[model samples]
Target: MNYQTISITLLILCLPQSEANDEAIRLGLKQVELSKDLNGWKPVTQSKQIRYGEWTTNAPIGQVGTGGGWGNWGTSVVWEDYKTVTSNEFERASLNNGENGLRIQSIEPFVPSNATKYYQEELGSFIISPRIDLSTTTQDSLFFQYKSNTKMNLEIWISKDQDSYWGIWEENPNRFRNHISATVAENDFTQIKINLHDLLIEMGQIFCDNERHDAVINPETNEVYIAFVAYDNAERRLGSDPKMIEIKSIWTSSYYSDGQLQPAPIDPVISFDHKCSSVTISGRVGETYELQTSSDLDDWKTSYSFTLETYFETYPISDFQNTTMRTMFFRLKHKP
Candidate 1:
């Protein structure tokens, strides 16, 4: 062909406002077909995997008995031991999973030597986790087994500074790795998986971009940097603590979405093509899509349906060769 023919072809390929036409290229062939649509659902062929297992081993962050001060007020470069950090409230226990877990005991309320207005409000322990990079993950969750004597509460926190637990909590925006509160009130050795995304949303609401609707979440600034913190926050009553909690086989894993945690269904890509006198609808393989067209966007009519046999199969597109309109809109519905 000549330059004139090439120019016309490029124009035809680029004319549509279709999302794919914008970022694609055509080689010796026609326009590179459109990309998959974002709205439809795809099937997840396999279970979610820990692309990178950051906490698979017994790698506690700080050295035991190295933390300092009351209520964890010291610069503990290492993980403080329960025996040393908890004013005699926490202990280390062996888990049936062959991994170690934490044990928290209720202690008698100490109103301080000078039981004055400054009564010991609570007794607790703090331990740091090795640096964790949440940058590449869309989901992060904690899995563990715990048994409680009475009601027990704990906080999972992140911090940029290894020593700014209080500073971060106090809204020193630059230091704190927002905290998530969890509680266990039962006595059975129950297993629990805590998804962190829910709590992160709350943190974003309070500390993200000062609450801007159009604000973008910069994971590099917001999540890339942080050390994990697991600590106890036991409220003291007059009686010896009853609602005690012991945890075993503690670790964190990152996945893509809530569905990815188990066998999940993923949405496939949907797109369409414009031909000489008809429209072609297509989708990825091993998936079926319903094609619908509408002239006013408000009302739509089903045109046809097609399913791809293989991921690479040249699946035929649904064609509409008998129509005449200045413009048209198409939407796709995925079928399991």
Candidate 2:
């Protein structure tokens, strides 16, 4: 390895933009998979034996009685079948590791498109995980994979209460609203590993009749109930279509506090993707790398390179010859 002081900022500005660019993909991201052993969790069903109670939706959109629909949670009656067959312009989603995931879907065929009047949809699923004796373990962060094309609407909550029940705003330490619809990126199979110790508290004010249903974040660990929801109002007249979501392999474990997502000493991993007419090279932060392409993998020639200065995860990869004429293979190697 060559040891020399290099100005990362100046190098980025001086580097010419190339049609075929390379990036560093983050490593150590592990998606928890489910097994036959119940994975130490009891799948709660829609039976009286379960402690889950009546489910309701968010606040109405425009006039009263306009948009208010309550959602029910059940282990037996959920999980919509997702397929990858002859499909068109719609975005597609799949399980992260295996065919085990929870799907929250609704076939609302009649979503009136009106710009002047704001529109909202009924969205919520209250799920209580089987008794997890975290009594002995220290949780670092929560991890899961999610994807959808439901007009980009989905949210999730974790409650401290071991038993499933409804509570008002008065319950502060009981609920922790971690992820929401608007915050989730519309990627196909995005993996999220949230560090609980460093996790910031996010909350919102919704309603249950006259009573207020709000989100509260707590620092202290507690046995809880996780709720997956897809409730948000349309800011404008959205394309009238079905709204849905699929969340798979929700798990909690000790997270590795490596600075991959941050701007620090990190390894670069490359992910080549074809978007639009060109390719996209995605990578993690840190380190200078060289990306080369050649008809034969041996005589590597054409290349454009850059060190990920900031945390931008994507750069357009372009200007490669058509595969019909000559097939080009790309590679990203760390340069000393």
Candidate 3:
């Protein structure tokens, strides 16, 4: 069994780019700021409990609303006053809307534990989600609404293992399968939707070992875990403070509903780069495609099957060649 790997480390730093074309394969990032329709997709149910840590001051357990209904689970760690303690004042506050929604201030700086000794320190906080079922074949999607009075950086992470816990207090927290960054909000509740399969391909394991490995979600065998991490630097005032970024109404769903007419599949654009001796294909993310080889251009054999994590992908032309042939033809085919 040969599993494919997407290596961000080698792709950018180590991989050699050919001058055949001055440009490299690039994919336009999905726009999360725009509002999206549910498209008949149902909301994924969430367990109403915090997997780790206690609620911050003013944020009590079991708050209500779409945001508060899902449960607020968060923790914070700080390098403060020069002396560290178990008690934290800068942890994320959970708000009640029906269920508790996690909140982090972008305007107010955290007071140093020892204000006398040090002027500032560093603070890290995160809100984690309970295990949820997200499948690849069905085009499962994650949706959430967020409101921010100020700009805030948010790192979203996913893991297939249910036991994988991420907390600032943990000695060795588990590494998520993939992660991506996004701005929290633009002063109001903004709806965002991300396809699960697309996310795995878009963000391939960056927090773990340097070696390349497959980041897959096997719904039959595993449940998915997600976490949102935010950082604050008091020394430099590099993070959000007084204004808050609130996340609520988080859910997952299949891209289409039952009997919904599927959209027409788009064909992949294939081209050859003689200088690099490679074949490049540009296609939509999450769509599985195949590269085929033929001796006479009539009987083509499938050589490789892959889903585009990015908008554009390139493969060495030599990999599809079985023998030193005088002539060989190649084509790209969409899979279903």
lDDT for residue 64 in candidate 1, whole number 0-100: 40
How would you order the candidates by lDDT, starting with the best? 3, 2, 1
| Runs with alpha carbons beyond 4 Å of true place in candidate 3 | 1-100, 105-120, 149-152, 162-187, 202-211, 214-221, 234-241, 253-336
TM-score of each: 0.33, 0.33, 0.36
Candidate 1 TM-score versus the reference: 0.33
lDDT of 2 by residue, 24-124 (tens): 01222223344333333333222111112223443444424424443332223222222111111111234443355665444333323321232233333
Overall lDDT per candidate, in order of appearance: 0.38, 0.40, 0.45
lDDT of 3 by residue, 1-336 (tens): 999997665454555322121111111111121123322222221111111122233334455534556454343333323333121122323434332344565324334333323333334455544445442244455555566432344455565553453221111223322322223433355655554555454333222122222332332212556665554432322242354466654554322222444346667888875544555676765689988888897898898899975445555556677786678888888875
Estimate candidate 1's RMSD in Å: 28.7
lDDT over C-alpha atoms for residue 292 of model 1: 72
Higher-ranked by lDDT: 1 or 3 = 3
Misplaced by over 4 Å in model 2 are 1-98, 111-121, 149-152, 162-187, 198-222, 232-240, 253-336
Q: How high is the lDDT of residue 137 in model 1?
A: 51
On TM-score, the leading prediction is 3
- Candidate 1 lDDT, 67-158, residue by residue in tens: 54224333333221111123343445543443345555544443322222221324444444433334345454444445643334544445
- For candidate 2, the clash count comes to 7
